[model samples]
Target: MADPAADAVVRQMRDAIMDTDLKLLQAVNTRLELVARLRAYKRSQGMDFVDQAREDWMHRYLAASNRGPLSEEGLHEIYGRLLDLTKAETAEDDPAG
Candidate 1:
């Protein structure tokens, strides 16, 4: 029962959201590549693969910067997943892993 013009507008909005999702994916991939480069450098220097202190620092940073309906805990949990994924990718790229 939707009007044709309204339907077209909805489709355009959906496409725009999809493009935004793609951009987010691209940004994540770019960050992962940077993590890989860091891993390579650390490996060459015989450094550890995991840095718990840095991860903790990120948790603190995100928690302090959170300013939304989402609780700081919620932000930490979501960002924790991202950090874990990044760590896993970096670990996989590490020569020691």
Candidate 2:
């Protein structure tokens, strides 16, 4: 049975979810910009921008801090994708890009 009121509530929640998605997109872009700037500064200082130890620490820290319905695999996937996006957005280091 299709209830109109339930449909309305679902529609409202979907709209809010879509808005959150837009915010995520904006956040990723902001992160990418900041990473690019940091990478440039590190390059000038004769240093490597991508720190493997820091990345490992971040994953551990986030996993410990997370408290939600989000699964461990989902969190790892999102974190990996975020790192990949930031790295791909920055140039000079990746010759293939």
Candidate 3:
């Protein structure tokens, strides 16, 4: 049962998976930076940074845009968590936070 060829394939697949994970992290960081800039502008304009309608539209847009293997429910869960993470991250950056 020692298929050396299969083992090598699996090893390469894992490396690709790790690279994808790093790309995802980098994308999240980039999104976070954009969000921080938006927040700063909103603050300067005396506008609320949290936009419920925009968030709702984003969820709907992402659901419509997703072509998957990934279920709609899974996307929803991950997106919800990402939104929460964004808020938590921005909060930590606040001086009064």
Candidate 4:
């Protein structure tokens, strides 16, 4: 049988990882909420959602936001995925309008 202490340690690590994931989920949710607001504001301005300038700005923002824990590429990838999802969401709203 596996050592009891080792099993306990694994459980502790798993719990910590879950807690971190929950926090990340909350942060991502907040970011998505902001994206939705941005979509609304753009609509008000008679502007399209897919703005190259905005994407460039996001790249610069992400570049400037480089901190420890996540590499720049990883950060970009995460935001890229978020942007993709945001675009899809906005597109859905458009087809129905």
Which model scores highest in lDDT?
3
Name every residue pair that clashes in candidate 3.
Answer: none
Candidate 4, 1-97: lDDT as tens digits = 8876579888898899999999988987787777777778888888777788979798888878787588888888887888887777655656423
Clashing pairs in 2: none
Give per-candidate clash totals. Answer: 0, 0, 0, 0
Instruction: Please write out the lDDT profile of model 1 over residues 25-63, one tens digit for every residue.
Output: 999999999888988888888887679998899889878
> What is the C-alpha local distance difference test score of candidate 3?
0.89
- What's the lDDT for residue 40 in model 3? 77
State which candidate has the highest TM-score.
Answer: 3
Residue ranges of candidate 3 with Cα displaced over 4 Å: 1-6
Q: On a 0 to 100 scale, what is the lDDT of residue 46 in model 4?
A: 88
lDDT of 2 at 53: 99
Off by over 4 Å in 4: 1-6
Cα displacement (angstroms), candidate 2, residue 46, comes to 0.7
| Candidate 1, lDDT over the whole model | 0.85
Estimate every model's Cα lDDT from 0 to 1.
Answer: 0.85, 0.84, 0.89, 0.79
Q: Give the alpha carbon lDDT tens digit for every residue of 11-52 in model 3.
A: 898889999999999999998998888887787788888999
